[model samples]
Target: MNSKIQNDIKELVEEQVISKEIAASIENYYKSKKGDTPNRLFTVFAVLGSTLVGLGIILILAHNWDSFSRSIKTVFAFTPLIIGQLIVGYTIIKKKNITWREASGVFLFFAVGSSIALVSQIYNIPGNFSSYMLTWVLLCAPLIYLLKSNALAILHIVFVTSYACSFGYFNGNNTPWMYLVLLAVMMPYYYQLLKNKKIHNITSIFNWLIPLSAVIVLGTFVKKSEELGFLMYVILFGLLYNIGKIPFFDNQKLRRNGYLILGSLGTIYMLLLTSFEWLWKDILRHEIIINSQEFYVSVVLLLVTLGVLIFSYSKKRIQNFNLFQYVFVMFTIIFFLGVSGSIISIILINLLTLILGVMAIKIGADKFHFGILNYGLLIITALIVCRFFDTNMSFVLRGLLFVSVGVGFFLTNYMMLKKQKGKIE
Candidate 1:
């Protein structure tokens, strides 16, 4: 605590406004709180600084790589790896410091990757990006548990997810189930961190990374069953949203809650895309079904989503019973109706979007949260902007519509500000 604050507490005690006991407690509370802030900040900077230093080393080597003889190139490749391993081993055995742990972990992570790249380049190995990432992540995986480094764990997930996307999604091949095995490698360390109740930035990083990785890697599971893939995506998003609402994650900031953010945005984007009639037409026109592994996965995901939705609704756990909450049901209905070639599906989808925006505005107004209100307005504005591309609408009508919507935006905001001022007065 600062001297001024200490003096202020003493003054309160002298004036008999607070007891000596209370003043002492306040001073102790502030002292402890102030102490933790710096350690957390230092941990953040140490990891980032180490990451930059490691990357710099790799960049310097890459630049000078072509000028070196093959033997020297091989020596340089293993040099960082050996040096990083020594640092990390020393950190684990002797230092056991946060800064050392993070710095060494980061350096070792990059060392592993750069070493693999150098070796591949020297041997002229015909490996793809996916193989390169997989090798690096596997080599780095043991560091997570051995060094007990959460940052390295995060790096492992990131590189592995990248590998999955590059190999499976981009290459149009099924992602090997080995992805699950690699993820499981980090789970023991993840559980240990959670058990320790470490509410640091590392915890938040895991919360965001794991869900995001799942979302990306799940796409690779889809193959010939492209049509059923929409169902899979909906189920995946619903499950993510529900998972984010768990007691452990729900208390976190919205940005840190990856599942909630990704699920909501993904659901909204999908709904908006399907709001167009052409997509529904295409689905009905090509009514093909392939009972592949993707089909089974979709069914399982759908069942899980259905269970979660029912439980949440029954328990009244869904705080925001907005359009996002009901989107899965709405989409399922629309999918069936559209399959039968009904134009009503298109109409209902548009109506749902309109209702979502309006309800968002109502909720925002009730709560007096302008950010939420503006978000609702932005959604409506996005819908309007999209309509500008419609050939069926005349250019004059579109221009007039834009002007009217702009006026509404300005007028509504003005009214809200006036109401806020009135409330203050």
Candidate 2:
């Protein structure tokens, strides 16, 4: 009887009698008890510890405002910076395991270096702000190597870039060489961050900040001449478009998006540049303008660069191109060729606007996107309405034009929505 019961149990097990729900519960039970590390507690301690240290430093500095002599205070000011350097040196020599305490200490040293520089500036030191900032950044660089503190390195880079923008570029030289130097200094940290992809947010922040600083600093180089400035915009947009077209950049959402944002801003600035009178009258008028090779070279480079970018981004799947971008590029070339003030200029501009509006509607069939199309339609409609204003048209005919446009807007948008719904279904 015992053998028979055992055989029956084995047969039942072999016949898949157990439920999937029971197997899942068993798996989860094993997983929950595998490890008991307290990750959250460590994170809380890190935040609280950094905040307390920052507050303590602030209080100490505030309390010692007026006690020391000029020379004595200056020496004391360098004391923390010296001590911080020692700590960084010790970390490197020991090559010991790093803990949260060590990381906090490195961060504190960074603050000390910054504080020393700030105090020097407050006391009317002879150094320039950029020089002082460069000193602080150099002093903090050791912390990255010794403690492997990405945060401190990143903070130092941020301070350096801010210093450059405020002081280095403030004079409006807008030299591209400054941008090249800044990027060089940042390249090391960028490489380090890429190795450890966990700090994605930090890397993304630098990606945006670096490009923005470049654009701002480069703005000074853009001459007041509208033709020159617009040509620069074309070059800027072409660079951005080429960057966007790279296959490796496809998955980099932040980097790609940053390029798009910069390109859009450059495009808008170009449009405004076109409408400026100084570009047409002041720069393009005299024989001197025609004689200058720089003017012609700038114009040709803009056109050639834009053509390359457009050709590169054109792919089989990309059926809709940005009409505004194309219009801006074409207008820039034609204007440079000396056809800007002719009667055909107005007609071309109006056509460009209408085409862009239609392209916007095709790409984003939403109410907000339709506004571009509506705006273009309104401009054309206004022109036609104005033609009938002076001489022969009756009130009824004038009113009919207004009514017709309003109806056209409603019907076109409704049809777009209908098409969208049909696609969804």
Candidate 3:
């Protein structure tokens, strides 16, 4: 049984917050579960301990590395790999539990990379850093399935992102197209994890990781019309925003819903970036090449975002119809206008940002969510700060605007708390 659940209701009843009958029902519900979520520390420390041991072995070997003969070095190289394999194999057959599986998978993962690096060093193998990361990721990806380890899955995504960075950045003409395939291969496992109907810590991690990986790697696809890359990003974020509205993800806690968080934040950030007058001024200098690769990617992204919006509509996932969900659609028109050297687009964006913040405050108040309300206040503050330098507005007016917004923040929060107290009484 979960110890925290037991303690919580016992305390609640003592405080006269709930009757004994309700407490008993709550206790029975949890006690009837086949398995509760594992204690967080157990899995974390298990994986951490195995990783430290693996590093220690490597460090010790490096100390005596040059003193040994080629045969001795070769033996040392394979020792950890062999031991890790045996442990993982045993885990699969008998000691199949979260601690054993994650520890073994992580240990074997590091072993595979170390062994490969050692072999390359001893044999003087010729390879770049990107190629090595690719090989390492490819070899360890199966560990995600073989051991059914979420820790391994998260590590796999990290390594995959690192590989993209190595292969795509400043390297001559090397596109990391294989990254999409690698990420796709891991989706089946993610789908299965979600279908389990429990929000494990690991579930929340993948929630953030998958989108983060894509957002990081998406920049690698920029070959032409470099400025349009920003547009592609906005559209991708919009797609992510729509994806968040899906029932499976929306019903989860805010921390677990990475698509919504990242999507909303990313959109706001891009909006802030675009609101600058100089950006559009620069875009006017360069030719808006519709024939460029970035343009094509942006088109695909817009279509996909639109498709998701329509699908979400059919399913009726968003209950309140968030205005920011259509931010992509709105920005598409704004972007074209900006590129055409229209000043109206920038003004519209400022208005949009202000409206978004206001809507956020309203939503937060309705939900009694202090965090959401504050986030909305921050959004407006960000916009005002962005506009501070660009316009010819005087210092007095700007200072007045700042003072007004600051006062609004305090009053809104105070009212919200007072209302919540009234409801409680």
For model 3, the local distance difference test gives 0.89
User: Least lDDT summed over 10 consecutive residues: which range in candidate 3?
Assistant: 31-40
TM-score of each: 0.84, 0.61, 0.91
Tens-digit per-residue lDDT, 188-232, candidate 1: 887777667547667777877887898888878877767777767
Clashing pairs in 2: none
lDDT of 2 by residue, 280-305 (tens): 56554433354443466466656665
Quick one: RMSD of model 1? 3.4
Q: What's model 2's TM-score?
A: 0.61
Task: Report the lDDT of model 2 for residue 172.
Answer: 48
For residue 418, model 3's alpha carbon misses the true position, in angstroms, by 2.3
lDDT of each: 0.79, 0.55, 0.89
Clashes of each: 0, 0, 0
**Model 2 worst lDDT window (10 residues):** 285-294
